[model samples]
Target: MAENIVQRLRDEIENGIVTNQFAPGDRLDEMQLAKHFGVSRTPIREALMQLGAIGLIEMRPRRGAVVVEPGPHRIYEMFEVMAELEGMAGSLAARRHTDTDRTGLLAAHARCEHSANADDADTYYYDNELFHHAIYTASHSSFLIEQCTALHRRLRPYRRLQLRVRNRMKTSFSEHGGIVEAILSGEAELARTLLRQHIAVQGDRFSDLVATLSQREAHSG
Candidate 1:
C-alpha cells in the first residue's frame, strides 16, 4: 500500500506537473500535494525522493522538492543519448525479435494509424507507447530494456506535450510505419536510422510546443 501510494503520486506528478505545468525551476508544494493526494507526508516524501533519483525533481534545503526543468541544451543532450540507445535497441531487435514481438509491434502500429486517422489523440498516445514498449521488449537485453524504459518514463511528460502539436500524431504514425517496415524486413541499419530520427526531440517545434502549452496552462490557471 505504501509503495502504491508512492507510485500513484509519481503518476500524478508525471501527468500533471512534469508534463510542463510546473515549468523550469517551479517549486513543488508538498503540503498542497499531501492534502490533494489524501495521504500523509511520508509517501509523498518517498515519491519525491524517487523522482529526484531519476533527475525529474530536485530537493532543496528550504523549499522542498522542485521540478527540474531541462533547458534547450539539456533537452538536446538527453535526446542525443536517448537516440543512440533507441537506435541500438532497434538494431538489436531486428536481429533478435521473435514472431510474437513482430506481431505485437505490427498490431500496435496498425492501431496507431487507425487512431490518428480518426483524430483520436488519446488513443494514439496509448498505442504509440505500446509500440515503443514492443520494440524495447524485442531488443532481448534486460539491462538495455530496463534503462530504456526508465528514461522513456521520465521523458513521458515532455513527449506527451510534444504529441499535442499540430498534426503530430499523424507524423508520428508515418514515422512508425517506416520503423515497422524496416524491422519486419530485418533491415537493422534502416530500423536504427529510422528509430533515432523518429524519436528526435531537438527540433524547433518541440521547444515551441512546450512553451505554447505552458503559456496556455498559465493563462487558464
Candidate 2:
C-alpha cells in the first residue's frame, strides 16, 4: 500500500510538472501535497525524492523541493548528449538486433502511431518512450540500455514539451519511420545518423523550446 501511494504520488507530480501545472521554481510543500493527495508526508517525501532523482525536482536543505526545469542552453546541451547516446544505440541496434527485436520495435512504433493519430500528446509521449527503449534493448548491450534509459527518463519533461509543439507529434512519427527503416535494413551508419537527427534539438525545434521555456519562466515569475 505504501509503494502504491508512492507510485501514485510520483505519477501525479510528474504529470503536473510535464503539463506545467508545477512550473519551474515552484516550491512543493510536503504537507500541502500530502493533504491534496490524502496521504501521509512519508509518501509525499518519497515521491519528491524520486522526482529529484529523475531531474524533475531539486531537494534543498531548508528550501524544500522545487521544479528544476532547465534553461535553453542547458536543455540544448542535454539534447546534444542525448542525440549521441541515441545514435550509439541505433547503430548497435542496426548491427545486432534479432528478428524478435525487430518485432518489438514495430510493436512499439505501432503504439506511437496510434497515439499520434488520436492527437494525444500525453499518450504519444508514453508510447514514444517505449519506442526508444525498444531501440536501446535491441542494441544488445545491458550497459548501453541502462544508460540510455536513465538519460531518457531524466529528459522526460523536456521531451514531453517538444511534443506539445504544433504538429511535432506527426513529424516525430514520420522520423520514427525513417529510423525504423534504417535499422531494419541493417544500415548502421544511416540508422545512427537518422537517430541523432531525430533526437537533437535543432533549428525550429530549439526555437520552439526556447519560446516555451521563456513563457514558462514568465508565468512562474
Candidate 3:
C-alpha cells in the first residue's frame, strides 16, 4: 500500500510537470501535496526524490523541491552527447548484433511504423523509445545500454513533445529505415552517421522545440 501510494504520487507529480501544471522553478510543497492527495508526507518526499533522480526536479536544503525544465542550451548539450552515444551504439550494433537482436530490432521498427501510420504520436513515442532501446541492447555493452537508457529517460518529455511537430513522425520513421538498413548491412560508419543524425537535435526540429518551449514559458510566466 505504501509502495502504491509512492508510485501514484510520483506519477501525479510527473504528469503535473510534463503538462505544465507545475511550471519550472515552482516549489513543491510536501504538506500541500500530501493534503491534496490524502497521503502522508513520506510518500510525497519519496516521489520528489525519484523525480529529482530523473532530472525533473531539484531538491535543495532549506528550499525544498522545485520543478525543473532543462533550458534549451542544456537540452542541446544533452542531445549533442546523446548523438555521440547513439552513434557509438549504432556502430557497435552493426558489428556485434546477434540474430536475436536483429529480430527484436525489426519487430520494434515495425511497431514504430504502425504507430506512425496511425498518426498516434503518443503511441509512436512509446514505440519509438522501445525501438531506440532495441538498438542500445544490440550494442552488447551493459554500461552503454544503461547510460543510453538513463539519458533517454531524462529527455523523455522533450522527445515526446518533438513528436507533436507536424509530419515529424513520418520523417522519423524514414530515418529509422535508413538506420535499420545500415545496421543490417553491417556498414558501421553509415550506421554511426545515420544514428547520429537521427538523434541529434538540430534544423527544423530544433526550431520547433524552441518555439514550443517559448510558448510554454510564456504561458507559465
lDDT: the better of candidates 1 and 2: 2
Q: What would the TM-scores of all predictions be?
A: 0.78, 0.85, 0.82
lDDT of 3 by residue, 110-213 (tens): 99999999999878988999999999999999999999999888877677767777788899999999999999889999999999998874334755767786
RMSD to true structure for each model, in Å: 3.6, 2.9, 3.3
Using lDDT as the yardstick, the better of models 1 and 3 is: 3
lDDT of each: 0.79, 0.87, 0.87
Q: How good is model 2 by TM-score?
A: 0.85
Q: What value of lDDT does candidate 1 attain over all alpha carbons?
A: 0.79
Candidate 2 lDDT by residue in tens digits, 1-221: 88978977887898788656888989999999989988889999999998999888998778899998666677677788889999999999999999999999999999999999999998998899999999999999999888898888777767876788888999999999999999999999999999999988433486676677668878887
lDDT of 3: 0.87
Residues 1-221, model 1: lDDT tens digits: 77877977876776666456566677888788899889888888887787787787898899888887666567656676777889989998898899999898888888888889998876777788889889999999999999888887766656765777887878888888888888888999999999888878424456777577668878888
Give every collision pair in model 3.
Answer: none
List candidate 3 segments past 4 Å from native: 1-21, 30-47, 201-207, 215-221
